[model samples]
Target: MAIISWREQMSLNYPPLDSEHQAFMKVINQASEDIKKRHIEGMEKMFQACYDYVRNHFSHEEDIMERIHYPEMEEHIASHQLFIKNISQFRQEFETADTVGKKLDASQKAMAFLSVWFLGHLISRDKPMKPYLVRLRNLPPRMNY
Candidate 1:
């Protein structure tokens, strides 16, 4: 089963950012599946992917916020930083796990953390940015960051 299912309410109504968010969630769900299948290597790769996605997506999103002069930019960036720290801690635990049972347990904890954090950030942080981001739709800016 998936760790977290993306729902309509999660949509920020911004396609570029929404797609980025969805891609990260896909990594999380895949990691959850890998844990169930005892695929430690797969989980490790997913962790790397998660790190990459956050780095790139947060940069991109932050840039957009800057462009739009979003009032909550600092707070949003702080939240992103906190997410990184928490995920890094989970990765440390997963990496230090020696046995299959230990690795699986760490993976579950990481997946649970990802699920909770992602949902909370999307609902509280990202949702509020929707109004500011909607302006970009008319401008049609590139999101390749």
Candidate 2:
């Protein structure tokens, strides 16, 4: 079962960002499945993918926020940073686990965190950016610059 699935309500109406979010869902769901199957060896790869998503997607979203002059950019970035810190802790737990049972426990904890965080971030952070993005696109070409 998926930790969470992509929904239309999650879309910011920006294809680039929306696509990234959708792909992120896939990564999280796959990680959840691996955990279910006791695929302990694959957990590291899943963690790496999550890390990569945080690195690339957070910056991409940040860049768009800069372009749009988002008022809450700092707070939004802080949330992203907090997520990085939280995920890093989980990864460390997984890595330092002395046995497969310990590793699976860590993976379960990580997935639980990811599921809650991703949905909450989408609703609290990204959804509000929809109007700003629409206005940005609607701006005249000269003014957009």
Query: What's the distance in Å from true for residue 17, model 2?
Result: 0.5
For residues 48-126, what per-residue lDDT tens digits would candidate 2 score against the true structure?
A: 9889999899998898788789998999999999999999999999999999999999999998999888889999998
Q: Write the per-residue lDDT of candidate 1 for residues 1-145, one digit (tens) a residue.
A: 7777889999988888899999988898888788889998998997898789888999989988988889999999999999898889888888998898888887888888888888999999989998888667666656676
Structural RMSD, model 2 = 2.9
- For model 1, what is the error of residue 84's alpha carbon versus the real structure, in angstroms, after optimal superposition? 0.8
Model 1 worst lDDT run, 10 consecutive residues: 134-143
The residue-level lDDT of candidate 2 at 100 comes to: 94
TM-score of 2: 0.91
Give the clash total for candidate 1. 0
| Top candidate when judged by TM-score against the true structure | 2
Stretches off by above 4 angstroms in model 2 are 138-145
